[model samples]
Target: GRLVEWGGTRQIIKEPRQEYTNALVSVHEIEHQEQKPGTTPFLSVKNITAAYGRSHVKVLKNVSVDIYPGQTLAVVGESGSGKSTLARAITGLLPPEEGTVTFDGRPLANRLADRPKEDLRQLQMIYQMADVAMNPRQTVGTIIGRPLEFYFGLRGRQRDARVAELLDKIEMGKGFIDRYPAELSGGQKQRVCIARSLAAKPKLIICDEVTSALDPLVANGILKLLLELQKEENVAYLFITHDLATVKSIADSIAVMYRGEVVRYGAKSQVLAPPFDAYTDLLLSSVPEMEIGWLEKAIKGRRMASAGN
Candidate 1:
């Protein structure tokens, strides 16, 4: 077999140090980013497997991650990567075909409806589409107040007062309490969803691509609001998204998933460091930059690297 050594260019030295047939890239570079440090594990999803339909097509394969109190665990991956499946499994909404979800110190029921009211109240999830998530006919006040009533039994003036408080926390005007979902802007509608989730006083909130639907500026503001609320409530977040920049901004621990498997998992610093896995490298290299000739430069870099091999 012909042998080759890879570098900036092919070096066809007949007298090589060792008999090598060919050089293949064994891995790719992938990176994660985060701030803050992990605390004791408040929520943990142990080895879990999930499937689609009854075809037994497994979409999630033995995936596990921990959400520590006062920290954010961001799950980053591309579309159809099973990020949302993992979220549902942990929340007991989709029920993992095999595995246990432990919260605080107790194991949660496999099905959400089977879980206790206390469990349901404490585990809140914000969906990507705020329009369909909230009832169109319900005013913002009723939407936010319902959680307070259902979870804490706050009634009459007490519930209304708490609703106003939550609206303030989400940076929505007090007047927004009376408006329906149709009356609010895209960002405002998402803010209502945030307010609703917070009204439950959940210890861990699963944010399922919460910002992907908003304008860039609005998304930034929403993220800032979440961070500020975290400081005030000491809540934990299981953030699911395909956005790397968001991962860099909010994650305490990052789990990079590919085709339903977690290829890389660690704190931001360790994961983002060099020697990235093959899939990770591809994903990282694919991030779009806002500059002239950026695409051409990236293509050139890849071509140059490929030429060496």
Candidate 2:
């Protein structure tokens, strides 16, 4: 017979039957309470200027961003806009020439070898091409089990069970465990990659166009699965994609990049609203609208707008 205050309203705390629900609510509230003080960013890239060679043709130009806990920051840009470069920098594949990357308040090491394995485990990347990212010769079990074995030191039946658990988490059943990469379809292959990324139990996952290769329906299913995993795991995602439709569905915040610069960055609702940036307008207009002849209209409108400017 206890009264509980929830959202400014008082309700009677019911019997022990409702304990599970009450416990969940309490946990949710505790998370909010823990977040009330707000720690420093989980990952921070500060004014990073990177290049491929000594001539220093800058691929990323003073680029800065943040990845916080339990949120998806979708980075959108056309090809050659430095999106993948940014991801590589975050994962320690490339070193910045001008700035620093800090993970959980410590500066990221300049080389992958210099980074501690535990630090590497906190940040994981899911590549666009599943075929290239995964080992074609390896079975799904071996592919997914490698991370668990490497990071957690599990092997034999333990590793296999963990792989099976990861597969189930990604909506793939246990039957596919023994299958090879060539045996599965594109979507299933990507799901296997997802399982591998999840195997590390990473705090942050950089999904570099993870769903782009699949058909729309299959991609949607993958996105839904990602949302479910985020809910259960508290995983943060740096989702890099050119697909505005996907961004609208999954992004909490969006950063629109063009020619290695952030043209626009804000909450999804704010950035997608009217008074859009010229590039953002062009990007939004390019999405296949339900109305017929939308592409032509968008193109003509952009041309006219450009002429006026």
Best by lDDT: 1
Scored by lDDT, model 1 comes in at 0.83
Clashes of each: 7, 0
lDDT tens digits by residue: candidate 1, 10-66: 232323333432211211111323555655589988889988787979999998888
Q: How high is the lDDT of residue 105 in model 2?
A: 81
What's the C-alpha lDDT at position 177 in model 2?
Answer: 92
TM-score of each: 0.86, 0.85
Error of 2 at 19 (Å): 39
Native-to-model Cα distance after best TM-score fit, residue 114 in candidate 2, in Å:
0.8
What range of 10 consecutive residues in model 1 has the weakest lDDT sum?
Answer: 21-30
Report the Cα lDDT for candidate 2: 0.82
Over 4 Å off in model 1, which ranges?
Answer: 1-39
Model 2 per-residue lDDT at 291: 44
Model 1 backbone overlap count: 7
